[model samples]
Target: MTPPRLRPLAAALALLAAAAGVLAAPAPAAAQSAADVAVAREIFIEGSEFAKQGNWDQARERYERSLAIKRAPITLYSLGVAQQQTGLLVEALESFRAFLVEPSAPATKEYEPLARQAVQDLERRVAALEIRLSPGNVAGLAVKLDGVTVPVAALDRPRMINPGTHVVTASARGYREVRRSVSAAPGSRAILVLNLERDGVARPAAGPRAVAPRGLPAGEVAAAEPAAGNLVPIALLVGGLTTFAAGVAVGLVGVVNASDAPTRDGDAADAARAQALAGDLVAGAGLAAAGAGALVLLLGRPPESAPRAPAPRAAVSPLGLTVRF
Candidate 1:
């Protein structure tokens, strides 16, 4: 419906409008983080240097910092490597898996095979523990492993852990607290069951001689009271005797030196005199300590039952009533 010159002009305007729209669109995500990219690059380089020195601990720390600032696939791969070298098998496996989840790009596509291998290796080497609670529905229950609280939601699954001894503790209102020690071996799975008993329930006798049932699981071992002995008194007695013997030995040496002093002159006589004085001081201290230890040991003993003293007698005297001692 319009003239030919007008149609050409309108077409030119539409083309210009389309070009402007393209320019106004947001830039690629990579172009938007120029400052962060610079900082991340610097930190990643530092991490790489640490890795070169075989200082994986420091390398892991640096890689973590860099990854927090900017998420690059290469950084994730590096972090996984550092974590693996630091004995963090579970964490390394997770990091490697995360790296593989990122889009395959030129910077990290080469690491895909390595990451997959790491995942398989970690799966075989990681230790896991499954804790089952008897009467799991108890109210106000709390569970801890190696002093760290475990979330209730995580109780259903096997937890990955480093290979070592770990203590698991459980407590609830109106229940006796329970603690158990578990040893986790590499590439092994352990299951522990904790039984919660109500407070005021009669527990097995926990005397020093009490022993757990032989067939019971380690987690179900009965609690026993530690052995009771007067160790302090015994230790003092033994130490005192040993010290006394040493003092006697020293005193004998001093006596021999003094005996020879009468036949010596100058420095020999002075040395003998000094030795004698030192021996006397040492012997005196030893004797005092021995006496104190003996006294303590004697005092620590239970008193023997003795006949009661006769009641005081009162008798009338010539001048007044008197009492007899």
Candidate 2:
């Protein structure tokens, strides 16, 4: 037996319990397995408990897991709340939009206005960033916003983002990378410009050929200018030529000694034989070194007309969702 005034309170309690039951169940269109429904219910309950304790991160994680297992309007709304609490305004806005688009039910009908209000608030809070590339249409150009790759198609338009400092990086093959830091306030729009320069062309006449060595004549230095960065090959060539000349001089002396040895004593003949062997070894080594230096010089010489590498297009990572009312 209940008092007359308490009868209304009892009816309200019964209606609230019915609403909770409806919220826990899957939508009419959802064909989730019984086991998945049970698991999602359990996780959703855990998330609710965490939210009550003001542990938004834990709540968000549990709600995300529950949603992954089974998506429910109630879970989406709860996830949006958690995301809003965690300062993810952009994500919260998306979650709220997703929730509002779900099939309306008596249990979720009350959340529609709330989700719409949150969306409006978040729309005002989120910031937008527009990125521009100098000398546009660069080949193999890759752009990243706060370490996440931005899609090329989205570059022409402003990107919705959270209010904070963001780092933008732009890079391309054979071009110097450009990085810029931008600060975005709530409801503000920012523009970032990236100017990329060709790499390794600051000095076209760089390397050893740029300067003439001490004691070298200007005419000889000018002649050597055709070979860029060819200092090592030139050094090897010079060393080989000097060695070959010494070997030739030694071999001639040995030949003279050998020719004179047949007329001299036995000891003189033995000395001449040793000298000839040494000269042959030195001459063979000099020939091999000279050949290697020549080969290296010929191979290392830069081509006069080389084609530029084809620029490769970078793959862009997708961000955000297309939401329609």
Candidate 3:
């Protein structure tokens, strides 16, 4: 009883001291070897020289190499800044994002502001184009932004675009090629749609007499015209007529058998079957009539002729017969 409380207090104090000691200990040295340091130094020197000379491309290369040796947030931020100066907005954004991943880096505040600005500028550049598509067709169509082919699935969302004029083209088999020119502002978005038309041999123009000289043709006129003749419609009509004739024959046989009744019980069954057959026959007859009508309509009417030039008046003869012009 005299020592239990003292033991627990002593254990707690020991644990606290160990924690303090761990916290006070110096961090382990970075694992960078001498060779790594030499490489990093060389890269830094080269990048600095490039920056001084305003050679942003070469500067970016050198800075990227230095980062490859060791992830230095400050170097990465500097590289992004150089890229931005060179109009590499997309690349700059990527670099800034990478730099921000370093939680312990002191340059996060500066990098974040610059990164946001770069993203805003990129957005503006993408917002200036207007895209329109025709025939409401969007299959197998690819869109490119600033020469980069954007995935069709990604078209619904905003994409990073570069400032300046963009050339857009749409292509698909069996459709005409469409091209458009668009301009994008810094940090803006552009919407574009492409219309596609069927590609086929141009139809020959009909003679003047074949042209319709009035308003839209009526449905009856269209149906009556022989120009609508095609194999599919003819086949459909034939099939419909055949089925209708078969149905009518079956119905007539059923009706005839039902009329010659024998016993009461059998007569009821026969009548029921006959009635069902009659219903089917009626349906088939309707179909046959429709088919016949369609076929007749298709083959019976002549195409509307174009207006013809009036004939010259003929000289009148004494015998009251008109002479030809």
Candidate 4:
């Protein structure tokens, strides 16, 4: 009953309906359970609707969920499209690449070129960053990108990231963790250098041993080089002073005694002279100890400390992706 000119239009409509029918039956390779297929189809339908409304974020979310449920090449391509619309150039590029690499099937043959084109276009619009520690072989060194650990082997390679701010952290067992934020523009490269310092050496010695207490005049503070107290010098001084006192007391006893005869003399006079000689020897030892103590206190070196500098820290928060390509 159709007019001759409308026959071609009717044929086209019939073909389109047939294609829809074919798509309605999940492709054999999809291999998803009935429940999975149902969920995936529903979510895919919602994503398509959102795409039609230009609600790209919602569309991307739905597409992502569908892809998670079932790894369909069609969903991946659609997900890539949604990502592109949402200003996620890097994500779109990844999705497109994922789609193309998925096992090729007859159903997905027609869209491969679209994926390739998208990848090519996005390649020129993203940024790359290289992170390195000054001493790459620092023991126990660990690096993280956005809090996810990055392997040591990958540290030398540049990461292709979205054009925005990203946080990178480098840490080690005995060294302070280094955190830095970098802003990347489209088609630009950013290099981040982390110079880590040993834990106690990363800050000025602001503890009790700080050369100057805060609020004191600059000159007075500089002149105040007192330690919390060095145990070595105090120990030596105490020992020397004690020895010197003991020697002096022994010598005083010797001076008070008159025993100067012989070591074997059993008489009181001989005993007194022996005691006096012993006292003199003790006093001489005391004098030597006291002199040594004074020399140590005056000439011994002050405590040696590793110089410290203020540490630099920055935090990288999630920033909205800038639309590129």
Which candidate number maximizes lDDT? 2
lDDT of 2 by residue, 40-140 (tens): 77787777767766788998998899889887777887888788888888899899999998998877676677778889889999999999987568889
Top candidate, metric TM-score:
2
lDDT digits (tens) for residues 1-325 of candidate 4: 3331212233233323332333356646648787877787777777776766667789789888987877677787777877776668888989889989888766666567667877888898889999878667888989998888999998899988888988988888877778888899998988888877666422333334334457776566434443323345565567766766776676666545544434445576566666666766765665665565566558645334422322234444544332111
Per residue, candidate 3 scores C-alpha lDDT tens digits across 1-325 of 2331112233223323332332233333775665775666567666766766667688778877877775565666667766776777667767767766766433235335555565555444433444555654545776666567866666556556557777887666666667777777776767766667656654444432333335646444443334344434555566677777677777766666666657546966668576757758665775876576576557643223322233224443333222111
Give candidate 3's whole-model lDDT: 0.58
By summed lDDT, the worst window of 10 consecutive residues in model 1 runs over 302-311
Model 1 lDDT tens row, 1-325: 3331212233223323332333233446866366766676677777776776677789889889878877766777778878888888878888989989988765445457767877888888889999998778888999999999999889999999877888999888877788999998889999999988776633344333323456655444332111112344556567777777777777778778777775666677778777777767776777776676677557654112222222234443343322211
Ranking by lDDT: 2, 1, 4, 3
* Candidate 3 ranges with C-alpha deviation above 4 Å: 1-41, 64-75, 106-132, 135-138, 203-325
Query: Ten-residue segment with the worst summed lDDT in candidate 3?
Result: 1-10
Error of 1 at 35 (Å): 3.2
Off by over 4 Å in 1: 1-33, 199-325
Better of 1 and 4 by lDDT: 1
- The local distance difference test score of each candidate is 0.69, 0.74, 0.58, 0.68
Clashes of each: 0, 0, 26, 8
Using all chains and alpha carbons, the TM-scores for the candidates as numbered come to 0.50, 0.56, 0.42, 0.54
Candidate 1: clashing residue pairs, number: 0
Runs of candidate 2 with Cα error greater than 4 angstroms are: 1-31, 201-325
